[model samples]
Target: MKKILSLFLGVSLLCSSCNDVLDVEDISNYNPELVWNDANLANAYMANLYPMFGNWNTGADAFSQQLAGINFYADRITITNGEFKLWNYGRIRLINQAIVDVNKGRLPDAVKANITAQALFMRAYTYFEMVRYHGGVPYITVPQDRYEDDLAVPRNSTAECFDLIIKDVDQAIAGLPKKIATTSADFGKIDANFALAFKAKVLLWKASPQFNPSRPFNNAYWAQAYEANKKAYDDLKAQGYGLVDDYSNVALVERGKESVFTVINSYPNKVANWDNGVRPGSESRGPASAVPTWEFIKEYPMKDGKMFNDPSGKYYKSEEALLQSFWKDRDPRFAKSIVWNGKVYEVSGKAGKRQYTALGVAHELDDFGVNPKAGVNSTNLDRYTGFFILKNSLLKLAQAEVQQYDVDFVVMRFAEVMLNYAEAANETGKMAEALDILKQIRKRAGIEPGADGNYGITANTTAAMRETILAERNVELAFEGHRFWDLRRLRMLDRLDGTTKHGVEAIAVQANGQDMPIGEAREKANRYELVESDFRYSLLQVPRSGVKVNVVPGKYYFFPIQRDILDRNKNLEQNKDWGGSFDPTLP
Candidate 1:
């Protein structure tokens, strides 16, 4: 299948003489009938839709850091009136055109069903993106053959847009196969499982606080979301979907059973640079981009299922103690997801040895030996936080380089489905079901159950369980590009306001005369110690000093539609609080 798709990519869209013939009074343009007639061509066209999946590593992940309180604000991120607009109609046009062609094509019912299902899925997916960003956009299903009334369709209501998304997904689910066989030619194709999972996610968003905010919380919406999530969870589980036993290798292992939907990339064709960009400065080929902030790092729970910062717990009194115990015996996911100070990582081409040095610390030659200076000035190219993301960093090789390996980027996995179910279930008063799911996830993470066989979650009340589920999601899905959207949908961005991002500061202390050529008898002496460890936590200044950053719920929840789009379409309305007049030019 890959080889066939590659062949299509290499071919020209039209013959060399076709353009010349058209210039000689042949004004009629060519239709994409060949693409619809051939299954391979249709499949190739569908492949183009895969790239539409978000590249979180490069784009939104960085922007999301502020909202998630995961990183110190390096620069103030301005919220503009044109943050994201429904300006790009190219994908929509192609999807609509494909749907039209697929319905009219002379293919077998089975073949046509799969192709049409995929086209509808893409269309729904695109519209979902638009609605999430800008509340209501014009729901145009049919391809615009000519300009006239079709070109100036008015904007639909937010509920109308969501209804259309659900409708399209339902059609896709009915037509798509339950499962794609491993031996089939189209192994990684979208199936009913993907559609169902997506439908649940959309419904969950619709029920979230940002979208369905009423004076009194709407329990009915939550119930609806709960039912949808439950159906998706049960159906996906029956189809053999479950979490990977080892969370560390989730990204390393491609298209495993845990993955329900993922963007598969292969070497030479498409490759992810996450490993190169997220590895620590000392180990990475280039400057690391996604540094894990102290705010995020401190969120991981202890091995005993207690918050690391709990006042009644065994909290680290000093900075030295914090760094010493921070990575030691904490949540298993912590070590699997982050590389902190003193965490030794394997390097290729030599016998790997455990080593520790604060990021950007300089090594200096001394009488005792080469000593690492903890207070040495470092560049931003070095990690701003003392930690780096370890989940996507494939550093087990002899020498890990940028863009060398093709790691599949997960979009939706079984673990996320479980988390969604747990949240919705709890909201709808299904406490026992939610707790069971939470216990399963916690057990997989190596968290021990309490005396009562619970995962130390004594909170059976809805409010407490809600808090528990949110925290679990935070740790379980950290750095997977879910934090920002999660915060936004919950209308909880204010939680990050007035918070300071932090990192660890430490100096390496070496034993006296350690660098000297010691006799065999003296070789057993202590070598070094990390001393005077301190937490470097500080409030970030935005738009100059003394201005605390805050996300206004009314204005900032939904992004504004671009000015040019409003100009082009007379019926379109700009989002409120954006300070724009909707003076549309009538045709």
Candidate 2:
């Protein structure tokens, strides 16, 4: 169904999520007393405060080099870089003011409760973002007056920050409805399920090594995460959220079955630029571009759920041989999410239009035509890497229709919730449970279940399970902005040190010189391009030859508070790892 409205729409018909400031319509001109007393006006006020939640573009993925950009070639992230600093006291104060005023509003008790609950949820969300970047921000629940209130508030401890987050989430859950259907008017609005899943995610981060480096695994923190995620998983499952059978169709529908929470999107009014980022500028109407890096391509497994180079996987071959067939026989998601050379990509409302990325590999004018253009103009998209992220692209959209791309951007989905639950379960010695979730996810991705029905999952031990879960998360949640945080939470940024991620740069040749078979790429090439064979692959580093990926600073786990923010707040201490007295990690 085409969702007519999102959370902003659910709150008030006149409200638009496009505007994320409280005073969008100069609400300051209206009497605060009258606005709060009126239900519709109060709802509109809160609607403006809801931060558009989904990472609609290449955001956190850039930090992990999953999406190509300058970040992919960066040497390291320093405290001075301030790559992750979210000190939004202004928004926090707004939420606090909303919570305070909504309570005093003369609306009915239920109406007052709903608005207050939503405000609290937003507050939790804002704080979560803050803590994720700069751990232990001031945990202020009430709006502070600049002139009267103590302006020098010290940063709260990590424990206190999370305590308040969970406390607010619990209260929000109590006031919100259990489940709001994606088809309902309140489709994108925060509900009990949304809050619960968010709580689980928050707890998962809290339990991670980012906060508790002392206890690596099997700690009280993981147990807390287990309970919250299990509750979320059970509650969400009972309410009918699961993996959409076909991966290709998952993001096509607005607030589809697997989505636990998504920001409501409608073209013109509130458009997501996801299409513009995925589609190259050649076929796209917008200039934004983000393609999968070589790291992400290798991260995906073979069709039966094994790495291309895995010794026990379906395909074990040399680096050259593997990258040659990299476009073929992979996790079914590879087909759903990648657009490589000679791949048939739908655009201009037509099927069988080939995307020729390799040099000299020009596509036929149309599938029925034998003639080739003078040059490889169709391949001009020449995506940064050898491929483009086809994840959630609107396949049938004509080039002009890209501006109308309004697919609901999923924030938290059942797949991620399951991953969260599985991680917690594995850390708590529930390997079987964790493995089961992985299997289900693989099944949904169309991985073939072998005779033993293992789906090529080989991890058995807890540590191995941890590795597999994190690896699975990379592929299952690629480009959704999860990888960088996952690496940080696991305290594994060291893995990126001196790492040279690879990308394929293909060039067409007269005869196939490569040893490996091109697999299904030939079939796709035959259907969409003038040349179907004799392509040679070049293994190129994603970055320039000498650029190093050194992430040595421990302070990077919790980004430092911005220098300006520190200059403004005299009492707020910097994190200990950042050469200050306060500790961001939990006690």
Candidate 3:
């Protein structure tokens, strides 16, 4: 396993030829005999597939605004066909080559089955990525050994591609291990549960409104999705997989009980310095690129499980009162996931001391002398949304050692599986089962269950339960990169269009004492006055220069196929609403 770590510790360590997999040339240097005969070599080849996993920490794609809901005005959506539109056949070719060689290898049946199953999983995973992003794609299973052979390949229908994906996953499940130890030796490898979980997710997406936009929702698709999620939930629970006791630490633990699948990492080999992007300026030298939006902050329910925006609730009397009490007596997840004003945080190597994001304290003395908002500005990298992401901050690292924090990114977890099952169950009229699952998640989040043993969810009708499940998913999975996709699949992206994102404005109270304290002390001394702003809309202004942020419903749903790809492959079709001279059918 250590050797496996060495082979896949960094993206640089992967075979250089991997990027050239799509190239139509002689790659006999990477012949099956050279890799498949040796187990270590075979494992190394499989390791290259890890990079293809989705970026979970940042909802990084044209569709998503930066994590903290800051930079709402940035050109988050692609206006035209971009690089991602260009089909990169490299990974598929690599998987095809692996499958080809694994079949020809002389390894023992058990060993060969494991390796082959892994290759199959990669193949299915790759195809799923393609279909999700580009609709139907060319379903190339066999390795293209020659340039002439590669040219003959044609695109397959979306349904056909999904069918192949399912077949590959089903076969992989048949051959993969049911479970493996969380120890370093087996922590990152795919298993039967991983396949099941992924399959359930795939089915749910297939049934989503984005995929099936017909007038009457597809009940059959929803039924299939429900069954798949139920099977995954039951089997995973049987295998001792369940939610971690604390929701805050779920991402911190490596291959914990909650993680069904994760992108494995090891220090120095595959280190992940998430702090480089999300850590506050006061904590690290890295840029604070993703800041939470006021929209996101308002999503969390009150401690009593009531919606924060409920008019009848005494959540706040005024904007100023809300700003002062927002971080106090709220959901336990708030403190663990967000860095707000007046919060005391520790800085590594700064022994017996703490850092505070108090307003009026000059965190950075600009040329204009002491700036009042410097403390919050420095911590927020000047984005000034009045909040920093703490969920995946990796703040334990010192300023100088920000790059060495290595924590595996959980791709799929039991909590999500339960949510998926609950949503599917609710859609299929299994209300009791749905509520039971929600209760378990809310209970783990420190929310008190009601007399009915449910998570105080009074919504018994399907329509009401649907909204509840979506809101719960938003908070529970915040900053883990599911919001954009969830909204897209639910056909709810229109909800964000023209919406303004807001934040609090904190002004520190200046004192006239000789030994005036700073940081947490200043906060405790009531030396800061927090003001809530009325113009908290995301579309109010552009946070990033030279970019327009707008979500055009019809055209923005699917990214356009690249023009170059259309020219290269005449058979390929452009997505709907993306006007181009390209035709869907070849003459």
Which structure among the candidates has the greatest TM-score?
Answer: 2
Question: Could you arrange the candidates by lDDT from highest to lowest?
Answer: 2, 3, 1
Model 2 per-residue lDDT tens digits across residues 1-587: 13323334433333343343354233333355756777666766776665547547745587675765445334244445555668877778778888888778789999889888988999999999999887899999997767678978899998999999999999999999989876687677889999999999999999989888898685689889999999999989988899998888777875677988877777677787777667756677653367677777778888878788888777666667766667777888888888776666776676667776553333322111111332333322223666777888886777788778888778888999999999999999999999899999999898999878989899979998999999999999888888878888899977654455555666554444533233344443556643324455666554443443544455578778876777888998988777788888888
As for TM-score, the candidate ahead, 2 or 3, is 2
Residue-pair clashes per prediction, in order, are 2, 0, 11
> Distance from true position, residue 484, model 3, in Å?
0.4
- Each prediction's Cα RMSD? 6.0, 5.0, 5.0
**On TM-score, who's better, 1 or 2?**
2
> Which residue pairs does candidate 2 place in steric collision?
none
- Write one digit per residue (lDDT tens) for candidate 3, span 1-587: 45664654332223365434323353644656656777776777777676777444444422444243433333444535363453657777787887777878877788789888988998898788777776677888887766547464466866777778899999999999988778757667889999999999988877777777763244577898899999999999998999888776797866689988888666777676577666666566654666676556666776666666556443533444555567655667777888765465555654434333434442441111123433433333235455667786665688787777788788888999999999999888898898888888888888755456565577879889988999888888877777777877787877666654445444444344222334544454233332222011121232432333454454455567776667777776677556643222111
Over 4 Å off, model 2: 1-30, 70-82, 286-288, 362-383, 511-527, 530-533, 543-552
Error of 1 at 110 (Å): 2.1
Q: What is the C-alpha lDDT of each candidate?
A: 0.64, 0.74, 0.66
What's the distance in Å from true for residue 531, model 1? 11
The number of residue pairs in model 2 that clash at the backbone is 0
> What TM-score, over all chains together, does every model reach?
0.84, 0.89, 0.86
Off by over 4 Å in 1: 15-30, 55-60, 64-82, 146-149, 311-324, 349-351, 359-376, 381-383, 397-400, 510-554, 580-587
